[model samples]
Target chain A: EHPLWEQIGRSFVHHYYQQFDLDRNQLGTLYSDTSCLTWEGQPFQGKAAIMEKIASLPFQKIQHSITAEDHQPAPDTCVLSMVVGQLKVDDDPVMGFHQLFLLKNDNDKWICTNDMFRLALHNFC
Target chain B: EHPLWEQIGRSFVHHYYQQFDLDRNQLGTLYSDTSCLTWEGQPFQGKAAIMEKIASLPFQKIQHSITAEDHQPAPDTCVLSMVVGQLKVDDDPVMGFHQLFLLKNDNDKWICTNDMFRLALHNFC
Candidate 1:
């Protein structure tokens, strides 16, 4: 709710997606040992496990176009962010996706502590 | 990450949707003055304002069918839950939706501290 939350949240989201699209391997800088990620209902914990799953994402080329996003400050100096966006993989058609991230400041740098991601499909896949 | 988070998250989601579908007015019991909600990019703070928005939702009858959900324990004993689901409003076609809630215990009762909601449409609306 504070103005600082908006600044922090926007900056974090920008850095996250930019790094994700450019080089997902660099995303490890945004997580730590206690980080947890739920990608399409599959849960992965810790930086190593999460990075392994991210690196094996099945696609070589991808781009994300964000449609809308909301950010709020949560308890304990954490920022909660939700994103609705479209992603293009290889030659595949653009697919809608929704993601949420809970970020906390560690050593003055924002690190993702929790993440949830899914393709916005009508039926569960 | 913790088993208790799953239990608490599942229970909270069940009660939340049931109350939402049955009587949205009763949904206020899950919020407080410090709560915040971002409903489709529109931000509302506190119980009174949030309830006003909920009460004015354009549809009289609605039914939600959850497709998938994920829950994890966050900092400071908070539970973060994300839900992917479909909802039918009145006689309209079913629409996909994604929502996230940050739940924390206050006086032994779980209260929603932050909520984000959006309908899964390809284009931002």
Candidate 2:
């Protein structure tokens, strides 16, 4: 991780979780107008669609345990992170997730442009 | 995965492994002129840069065991696949990798635009 980007990455993720934990309704503010999200197998673009996807998630309580995080600087900053955590709506097994985020830093704030999340396991075995 | 996309996805992965196994140099043909590749935490763009990055990998033999694949249809088709497998140069442990591929279908062929890869494990334990 770049020295400057490490700070930005840590702060960006911290701020994201804070806002998300408080109210997912405000999640739209973290993304640009043209941002996109790929959750599970579905893809949604723009704020309205992205918001709808998050709001419809079956899990009401989500806890993310970040295992590894890496940052790359380019046309846009990309952070690849791995999380093995638990999510509960009623009752669910602990699941693992691998996420990739593409963010743009504008006016000292980072805005996500592309987000991808999928199961961490390659096989049940 | 969509029915059509499933076939495309399987064939794509198959062809990729075939070419990659034959010669890493041939991997460039699978991407467009303006494609981008994010290997581990490093980002490389364009054919020259992407090729350079692949050709320089420490591994002499790489095998990707795709665990799950999901496809989304849009302006450009995006396939999110999780792979956990091995990489070896002379003698190396079987390292697991998670990869995401952003593909565009043009002229009845799929071309990768953005490829991201990261470690699958969040914690070593």
Candidate 3:
């Protein structure tokens, strides 16, 4: 597995667990300023804004199991698709949602520039 | 411009005009049964079902301009991305939304197998 993949996995886990213990600044540094995140049809732009929005969600605990992942890399751009299995609040298995992450390589690190996802509520109910 | 491109452009225009005057059945035949469409936040499956759902919408007039088009063709699959400018009902020029169409070549023709889009409402409002 690539080191960046491991980092992404850990970041997601940390965020899901609301373990705000991790350095929040790292999230902004890892994602690009132009990044667009659409969750359940709600749009949030930039890493700092998205971080604040997510932090505001009233979730006690959360976990995600990545079911499938596909990554395509070009010289400067990377497209990633993953099926995520989410467990939240009432311990309900929120089926799975598809997430497409578009990343651009800056210097030597990958920073997400576009993030699109379908929510469980939109898919199941 | 490719012949297939012209056909797609025409089909979209015909459907948008509420030219329910056009062959409605052709819509079903043009799209694959497994195609997925998400409008706003609601998800719909299959061409037949999607057509039905669209027909039920209370729209007086609709028009779309293709702002951008990108097509990548493999031996068996074609991926298309389009930015569509929509004009609907109240004569408002809705900002464009991105639509991704995944098509599989069957026999000699192409049919959409996966259709993913960010609706105007989801993107602008």
Candidate 4:
């Protein structure tokens, strides 16, 4: 295990959410052409498709408040992170959510390879 | 993308939860010496340590009901799966949780290389 895996993972997650809350348009820079994302059961592949899906989200304003997070180093040297948090969208009440991200190093820069998000509500499905 | 990744991912997840709910003792066989798990923010490496943690859970009776699941084949050919669901413990009310797994093929058999789990309760932490 790399001694810096935890630190790198934590910092990457912080940067990700910060960018997401501030301006989702900048989120695309954190992904690459080979990236994939599953948002609320919908799947999108590649940078363009993923960015399109993100930009099309129905919510106008969103803020993520992380309650807990876990990180691990995969055998392939990628960082696997799971984040448990609450989010406020527009004027709606706060809702809980779970998100997972697999980040890999590409030319000395960390980029997300896979991402999955789901709302943590009993009746949401 | 592998044509059978989704099917394989779904089957693997079904088998995993089935064994977990029916008899966690059998769960050890699904992991390998290099497998890693993070349960409720605690990290455990290798199969023996992971199994020890799983067997030490305080709950006597537990059941999981999955509401949604997402799967994607990573660039390294590993299957990344994220599950959102509810669980019942003893006489406690159903509580939402999120679990993630990365399954890799080894010697013609799929084994869980990484696992992360967390409860989705507000005010619990």
User: Which candidate has the top score in TM-score?
Assistant: 1
Q: What is the C-alpha RMSD of each candidate to the true structure, in Å?
A: 2.4, 5.5, 12.4, 2.6
List, residue by residue over B29-49, the lDDT tens digit for candidate 3: 657676666554356777878
Record all residue pairs in model 1 with backbone atoms less than 3 Å apart, i.e. clashing.
Answer: none
Give the per-residue lDDT digits (tens) of candidate 4, residues A16-124: 8888889998898889988989998888999999999988889989999889989988867898999988898999988887889998999899999999988776532
**Model 2 Cα lDDT, one tens digit per residue, A1-125:** 45675566666766766676667778888877677687875778798999988888766666555555555443324432322332323355656666666566668777776676666444232
**Candidate 3 chain B, which ten residues in sequence have the lowest lDDT sum?**
B72-81
**lDDT score of residue A14 within candidate 4:** 90
Docking class of 2: incorrect
* lDDT (C-alpha, whole model) for all candidates: 0.90, 0.62, 0.49, 0.86
Residues B11-112 of candidate 4: C-alpha lDDT, one tens digit per residue: 888898888889887898889998889998889999999999999998888898888989998757899999888888899887777889999998888899
Write candidate 1's Cα lDDT for A1-125 as tens digits.
Answer: 55898788888888888889999998998999999999998999999999999999999988988888899989998999998898888998888888889999999899999999988765432
Error of 2 at A109 (Å): 3.1
Chain B TM, per prediction: 0.95, 0.80, 0.65, 0.93
Off by over 4 Å in 3: A1-26, A74-76, A90-95, A123-125, B1-125
In terms of lDDT, the best-performing candidate is 1
For B68-99, candidate 1 gives per-residue lDDT tens digits of 98999898999999998989899998888888
TM-score of chain B of 4: 0.93
TM-score order, best first, reads 1, 4, 2, 3
Docking verdict class for candidate 4: acceptable
Candidate 2: stretches off by over 4 Å: A76-91, A106-108, A121-125, B1-16, B25-62, B65-96, B101-115, B122-125
